[model samples]
Target: MTEPEGSEPAQDLSDQDIFAVLDSDHRALLELADRAATTGGADELAVHCEQLVMLAVRHFVAEEQYLFPLMRQHLPDGDRSVHRLSDAHRHLESELRRLEDVERSPQAVGPILADVRARLVDHVESLSQAFASLRGEIDPAEAQRLGDDVLGVEQLAPTRPRLDHSDSPALNKLVSLVEGYVDRIRDAYTHRGVERDER
Candidate 1:
């Protein structure tokens, strides 16, 4: 059966379910940050960080504009927490911009990523705690509406997400590189019986 298009649909997450996505990413980012901190970063570390910045910028924009308001209606304290998260987004944007500016040197990338990583860690911690406290206050249905809005966002990670051998080996190589990360994340968080359905 096809899943529901909204949050209430099969595997569609309620507020906590939506937060779980962010929480998972939060942990992944920490692992990436840890690697960057301990060993010198691999060449693609910066590239991956840029991808993360883009992903997060999109995710946060959608969340703040749509998701948080749902919570605000249900929970009186949500407005304040949302504001705090907005401030965190501003800070994160600044850090992302800084990361974007330094292209060549790992030296330049490391310290800035470290700073941003620290802030993200703290932001996730604070948001998690606050949201947990207020989760009981949110209506499941409204949260689903907010999640549906996220599903309706009008962009893709790639305009043409298809994979073909029509181009250079570079394209296939890049796909594999990303799939590797996906594999790690799935192994870390998903069960063994899960299927990989790119479509």
Candidate 2:
């Protein structure tokens, strides 16, 4: 994924704190949103949307599993903030599903895409504010430890949306593993086909 202009180079999550990792994901998502907004064709728009969905699912899963719980523990009003964020997540997920169908008719996707972008921008801003508050209350070491925990959660997170298993981390991880295998097989097939065509 491309880093946003003026952003720092992408680094391994192990090398950065939780804020940095989340910021990176937010920037990448914004970039995808911009691309989706400007895409000319249905195919191109659909590709951007798909990338957005995958990034969003993984990002949310990591946050829900690691970051938010920590926030709830550290921040005074974290419970309310986290609840609001969770509601936004559900709304965004629903929009993502609609986007999949809207992409099939490119003309119909513009408004929905705009809505998604707006919601994402708002969500990112809220998260940044919450993290800033969190950082003030915790030591750097604790923040770094939380970052490591987030990295671990991300490792097992699914790239695709798990609508039915939203509340079950185990199920989501299993589905993600299966999805990863399928994606690898599909990618290999496509690569081989391209190579044969070139030959």
Which segments of candidate 2 are over 4 A away from where they belong?
1-13, 164-199
lDDT of 1 by residue, 15-100 (tens): 43455544544655565455445444444454455444544544554455455665566566766877677677677777776765
Off by over 4 Å in 1: 1-16, 35-42, 151-199
TM-score of 1: 0.60
**lDDT by residue (tens digit), candidate 2, 144-196:** 88778667666555555556544444565566667646654754554411223
TM per candidate: 0.60, 0.77
Provide the overall lDDT of each model, using Cα atoms, as 2-decimal numbers: 0.52, 0.71
Per-residue lDDT for 155 in model 2?
A: 52
Which candidate should be chosen as best, given TM-score against the real structure?
A: 2
